[model samples]
Target: MAAPGFLEADGRNMSRATVLMLMAPFFALVIFAFLYPLANLLSISVLEPQPTLEHYQRVAENPVYARVLFRTLQIALLVSLLSLALSLPVAVLMANSRGPKAIFLTACILLPFWSSVLVRTAAWAILLQRNGIINQTLQFIGITDEPVRLLYTQGAVVVAMTHVLMPFMVLPIYGALRNIPADYSRAAAICGAGPLRTFWEVTLPLAMPGIIGGFILVFLTALGYFITPALLGSPQEMMIATLISQQMRENLDWPFAAALVGVLTLIVTVITLAFSKVFRFERMLGGRV
Candidate 1:
């Protein structure tokens, strides 16, 4: 009895409602798994043990906590920068190359994703040991006669973290580079720009979004990184995450641990918002707001 247009409109409304129905589970999961837990933790930090800001105040006032936080930031920054430096040229190469080389390179980059982080950290532990391959290689190459104590240092932590986080940096950059048009490079060449000049001007600027994305990804992931650093780093290099775990599990100071978690969450939120404000994350991902 309804007009044809009216039936089509009804069908569209049903389709929209169906889509919402499909999405309902995902929203429910987020609420239960992420938001609810975070809210509970934050509330515990403030409300547990007679409702106090004392937990937060202790974290701020303690020099050890302050040092650990600062050290965590330092290590994260170092790993992010190192990953970016190593990723860019590889990303460019992957975007430009073809045949088996590209496939092989991509597999090499992606293969690590299939492995567990614990396994990777264990491998690094073996390789960087006093008599391990790297030290032996160094000895063979006359870099050092005896083992140089490489296993449990800040440098070792950064090296392992960079390797683990490198894929994150490379993939975003590769995606960004792949999205850039070939004509842009060609146009620069036609405009009498050399290869390096064209890259420095056209390619680099165009790829900034990806670079920024990769940097943030690597940086943020490195911030709370626990396994690699815990395995590789010494007590002197203990990061905020390590401290938080100790507080929660070893010390059994739930309220203080909750407070540390709150602080870390706040820092992460502020950094994420700051980065989003400074850069167009959607633009980098080739999308529009």
Candidate 2:
């Protein structure tokens, strides 16, 4: 009854419209639940009562806040470097191994992730305290006349965070290493390259992408870490998250707290974008994805 092909075309158009309608709720939910809340939080940095940049100015002007920010960066840098250093050999071994050895190594990397962060932090607190296992062992062996102060230190926070985050570094690097073709290394050897030379010239460059990705991931997480530092370190070692929490809950300063979060978010966003731009080589880094 309709014009030639017109009815079929109309039917196709109607189907497309129906599909779009079905997808609308999902889009709405994403905007409302995630994007909207993030936008609101960011707004707090500049928008209070009316709108002003005073909050950001205060953060920049305050020596204490500035010092904390620097400390945050320092801790993040150390954690990222340490995590990379520790993860590489483990990743290499995991990539090379098979059967039970591979399974055991992988399990070790994943075991800590099975436990809650709070539980891990608490465990460290007990183990690192003055009367804790390490101190007691030292005292028993006559290493010290008294239990040394191992807990409530920056070193303690760094150690706990490194232990907690080592897996993140390992998995990415391991995936990358495993994705590398064995033939490349074999070819290098056939070309009369020594073991160290082949690895340095071939494997290391290829593995760089994974290394950088893992570095960024560890750094970002360490930047935002709260529980380990809070539990293991003194007040002076407080990180940004702890500071934000103190401002919001203890001081009842939502705007300032939100501003702190906003600043941290900005720093992370900038770093991530920059890293992505500079390290498009991540795809070449093997299986880091």
Candidate 3:
């Protein structure tokens, strides 16, 4: 017969083992679906007819490819900034308001998410095209003598991307704001703090984790984006995604396209890791670590 304490310890160990057994399938799926495919793609970049540094050299040395990479970064930065700026106020309003106002705002935020991204991009293309609705409306109002070129421009691409990505920025910020306790602001007011001061000093700092999270999500997603830029942009505005497509489809260069994919993946992975580190720091400072 076992001592009571010895039996209790055995039961605890079995419970821990059971938990691991339950988690095994999830870990296996992640390895197979995510890591394996990514490893295969990265291999394509280097595994040529023979192992080569040539593709990476071509990407770095060629002015055209370098310019395209630079353009993609620029566009991603602009979209991320614009998305953050636009999302903040909407997030604040949703957090503060109640009743019908809150319901309407939340619905508006989620409306775009329910629709297909492809459909949204196509709609923007029609709206912004030279002979499309926006141009026609402007011409009809005598705002311009001619239909101004709007579609197939970098500006149009940014505008459409910002629209699609705005929801991503807003949701996280709202979550952060809602998590902030109400009494902190009330106590500040009681202590003679103005509303603006209280918000700036207390509310903003507390909600920063969410803001940073939203920024990273929007920035990374925008970086890998393909369809919006492809449809809404010109050759001069071509992003990395379009370049990869051109290589694979038109140039019939799978290895080179894979190299482009590898570069993009590396950049995104680094950015995500950096963001995760920053988030951990923020959480520690906020006492939530």
lDDT of 3 by residue, 1-289 (tens): 5334433455544454555777999999999999899788778878875799788989998999989988988998999999989999999999999999999999999999899999999999989988998999999999999999998999999999999999999988888888889999999999999999999999999988888878888888988899999999998879999999999999999888888988898889898787777676444222331
Q: lDDT scores for all predictions?
A: 0.89, 0.85, 0.87
Model 3: residues with Cα > 4 Å off, grouped in runs = 1-22, 281-289
Candidate that beats the other on lDDT, 1 or 3, i.e. the better one: 1
| Residue 13 CA displacement from its true place in model 1, Å | 13
Candidate 1, which segments miss by more than 4 Å at Cα? 1-22, 286-289
lDDT of 2 by residue, 4-122 (tens): 54434645433545567779999999999988998898787678755988888889999999889989899888888888889999999999999999999999989988899999989
Instruction: Arrange candidates by lDDT, descending.
Output: 1, 3, 2
Better of 1 and 2 by lDDT: 1
Candidate 1 local lDDT, 99-159, one digit each (tens):
9999999999999999999999999999999989999999999988888899999999999
Superior by TM-score: candidate 1 or candidate 3: 1
